[model samples]
Target: MKTTIPVAVAFVAGVVLVVSFFFDEGTWVGGISQEFKIWMTIVGGFTILLGAVSITRVNWSAVQRKKEGWPYKLLTLISIFVMAIPSVLPNTWSPLFGRDVGSIYDWLFTYLDSPMMATMFATLAFYIASAAYRAFRARTAESTVLLVTATVVMLWRVPMGEAFLNMFPGDIPNWLNTYVMNGANLAVQRGIIIGAALGAASMSLRIILGIERTYMGKG
Candidate 1:
């Protein structure tokens, strides 16, 4: 009974939204769809609050238990509060406490957060390069083709690639990279997107029909 009501509401909402897209803008169905979209945004904000509450509860519990990595969790909790408190302060109080430009939260975000993000991305680049080196093997025909194409694309983007290619008469590498990326790669990307959309539609239909009971906490 608990799951049935929510499932019915979801099914009706989904059908209304799908139909609204095809209906005229001035129609009642379209108006209802617009209202539903506004409700979705409100629900999204509440979901963020729920997520914050869940994270705080878990981190506080870990800190209380003195669990492994509790120090990090505590730091995370402190950081969240530090970042949030300033934003919630009154505009009048914010300027008095230097919470506008050189404020604690702003400084931390600018100097600390920015550097941390850059460092993380730099670290990820190394990991990506390592993964690429391991994966780019010429074991099969497909792998050979992929490795060659990737090599050409990477080289064509750099000055050295252009320099090397310039030595050989025609602009073969440039043409190959441009055509493969814009033509072949784009077509594959479109195919993947279409497949994903179809898969999502199938899943949505299953949920609407009550065939996907997994969403209702049932295996």
Candidate 2:
């Protein structure tokens, strides 16, 4: 009964949203659906405190265990408290002591967090390029066609690409991308969209009738 109510509500709302596009008269349903989403978001924000508490508990326990990078854990706790405590009780903003705690939090995210994520992604670029190079090698005629098409499109994506394409008679890459690659990409994307929509619809139907028991957890 606990899981049933929320799941039923979600399924009904999802179906209504899917149908709302086809019927102008059902626009009121869309407004109500959006309002429900806003309420859910507010409730979810409050519920997230539970997650914050859990994270703190787990990280603190790791530090107590004398795990590696315990110093980093200490810094994380400091950062959380620095942001949370200030935001809780109001205070003045200062560039010296640190502007708004929110601003400091934003700075931390934009600078420290974003750079770490970017560096990790930069590290993966070499490996991705190596993998693509290995995969692009063709053995069969069908493979050759796919490889050539992919190569043409890839070269056209850049400025120096024209240097490579100059080997061809005319604007071969532009013609291929505009006429050939564009059509193939669109067709493949549409097929994927249709398959995804059908899959979602089937799964949603099962959920609505309670065939999907995974959401029930223990019971």
Candidate 3:
């Protein structure tokens, strides 16, 4: 009964949303679809709350057990509360309480979180360079072509590299931008997007018809 109810709701909601796309906004189907979207947003908010609760429980359990790396788990719990508690408080209580520009949450996110994220990505650049070196080895004709194309593209991005390209006979940088980036890259991206859209539609149809029970935690 529990599984049947959820599947029925999913089928009805999916059909309504798909059908509503063909109708005018003022029509009953469209209105119902809009309401359903609002309900979806509300459900999304609850899901976020549930996720927070789940994280708290897991970290707290680890801390209580005095597990290896429990100190990091304890820090995680402290950081979560330090960021979240002030953000949820009424701004009327104190200027720094809510998520406004000068508030605790805003300041921490901008100064602390943003810098850490930037530093992490900067550190990752070395790993990316290592991976690129391994990937660009010209073992075959296709790989040789890839290595040359990548070298040209990377060279085109910087001032010294652009100057080096300009040392050549014709407009090499312009040709790379026009052909490699705009022509080939755009075509490949479009093909990938179209394939992904078709796959998503197929999956949605299967779910709507109840043929996909994997989402219901079943094979």
Candidate 4:
């Protein structure tokens, strides 16, 4: 029953979404997918409250104990609530806080959160390059092929990279990214998405079957 339930939902939802994308002629199928997404969004919101409560409880306990950085913890809790409350309001007109609370949230996401996330992601380029360099020695024929592919794709990715090499006689970089590189990346992306969908469906099956008792109350 557990496996069958998830398989059913996955089969129905996946087919409907795929059909909606391809057909685009009917409002009914699209509406169903949109409603499912909204339901999932609500579930995500409630799950977030679990994490927020855990954080607040730890910070409040620290403050009660007179920990050295207890004031900072309190400030963190204040910031979380300040940002979250407005976003959760049923409508923009709700009396959550100041009239422009939504604007404040948007500003934080644009200027503060976005730049921080970008910086973190940018740092990964260096780490990936270093790891590839160490791990991609051309000791074997297969290794040589892998190394060449990785190097060519990496260098062709940027303008300066294309300019740095005087040896490329033709439009090698442009051709690679336009043809080979893009094809490989797109294939990998599609595979990842399919895998993720399957994983989510399997987890949903566990939850619906009561096998995932982690969400249930203490027995």
Candidate 5:
């Protein structure tokens, strides 16, 4: 009975949203559907709160037990409260500490968060280069094509590549990078996106029909 009610509500809401998208704005159903979307946003915020509670519960248990990595877990819990408290303060109160943008929050985000994000991406670039080097070997015709295409694309992107290619009469590398990459890459990307959308739609339909009862803790 519990699962049945939620499934019915989800099905009806899904139908309403699909109809609202295809119907004219002047229709009353469309307007009500838009209001329903706002409620969905509010529900999404609650989900974030739920996630925070879940994380805190797990980490606090670890801290209580003094488990391995307990110190890091404690730091994470402390950081969460430190970041959240000032963020929720009213603008009037914020001015006393300085504007949220100019406060400790901003300083932490700028110095701490920005550097951490930058370091992560910088690390990723080396990993990507290593993976590409291993994968782009010319062992097969397909791999050779991919390797050559990647080499041309990389070359045209930098000054040295362009300078070396400039000694040739024609701008073949530039043309291949611009036209071949743009045209073929765009088509492949679009196909993948459309396939993903269709897959999501199919899964959503199954959920709405209750054929996929996984969400309700059933088969």
Candidate 6:
């Protein structure tokens, strides 16, 4: 009954959403589709609450057991409440209570969270460079072409690299930007987008028809 109900709901929702696009916003199907979207947003809010509860339980359990790295888990729990509690309170209570500008939430996100994220991404740049080095080895014909193209693209991005390309005569930078980026790259991207769209459409159809039952958690 659980599986049957979810599948039926999914089918109806999918059909209504798809059919809604063909009709005007004032129509019955369109209204239902809009209502479904609002329901999805409400579900998303509940999902966030569920996630917070799940994380708190896991971290609190780890801390209670005195597991290795329990301090980090405790810190995570503290950070969650410290950030969340203020944001939910009334803005009139204090200047730092709500999520508005200059509030605790805004300050933490802008200063602490943003810098931490930037530092993490900066650390990842080295790993990306290492991967690029391994992938750009010119042992095969395809790899050699890829290596050359990557070199050109990288060079075209920087001032010194653009200067080096200009040393080779015949407007190398212009040619690369015109043919390689705007022409070849754009064409390949469009082809990939079309292929992905078709794949998504097929998957959606399978889900709507109840053929994709894996989402029910027991296939």
Which candidate number would show the highest lDDT if scored against the true structure? 3
- List residue ranges in candidate 4 displaced over 4 A: 1-43, 66-72, 82-111, 125-143, 163-171, 182-219
- TM-score for predicted model 3 compared with the true structure: 0.95
- lDDT of all predictions: 0.85, 0.76, 0.95, 0.74, 0.85, 0.94
Can you write out model 4's per-residue Cα lDDT over 63-163, one digit (the tens) per residue? 89989998899888888877777665555465443435456566666677789899999999999889876876999999898788877776767767778
Candidate 6 residue-wise lDDT, 31-54, digit = tens: 988999999999999999999999
List the candidate 5 regions with Cα displacement exceeding 4 Å.
96-99, 132-135
- Could you tell me which residue pairs clash in candidate 6? none
Candidate 1, residues 1-219, lDDT tens digits: the string is: 798898888888889899999998799999999999999999999998899899999999999999999999999999988887785676576552335677776787789988999999899889989998787689999989988888877787788987777788778676766788778999999999999999999999988878887976886
CA displacement after TM-score superposition, residue 42 of candidate 4 (Å):
4.0
Screening candidate 1 with a backbone cut-off below 3 angstroms (N, C-alpha, C), the clashing residue pairs are: none
RMSD of each: 2.5, 4.0, 1.3, 6.4, 2.1, 1.6
The residue-by-residue lDDT of candidate 3 on 1-219, one tens digit each, is 978988899999999999999999999999999999999999999999999999999999999999999999999999999999999999999999999999999999999999999999898999989988786589999989988888999999999999999999989999999999999999999999999999999999999988998988987
Identify the runs in model 6 with alpha carbons over 4 angstroms from their true place: 130-135
Scored by lDDT, model 6 comes in at 0.94
Q: Each prediction's TM-score against the native?
A: 0.88, 0.72, 0.95, 0.55, 0.89, 0.93
Error of 3 at 109 (Å): 0.8
Worst 10 residues of 5 by lDDT: 91-100
Of candidate 3, the 10-residue stretch with the lowest lDDT total is 128-137
Stretches > 4 Å off in candidate 1: 96-104, 131-135
Which TM-score value belongs to model 5? 0.89
Q: What is the number of backbone collisions in each predicted candidate, taken in the order shown? A: 0, 0, 0, 0, 0, 0
> What lDDT is reached at residue 182 by model 2?
74
Query: Following a full C-alpha superposition, what root-mean-square deviation does model 3 have from the true structure?
Result: 1.3
Q: Per-residue lDDT for 110 in model 1?
A: 87
Task: Report the number of the highest-TM-score candidate.
Answer: 3
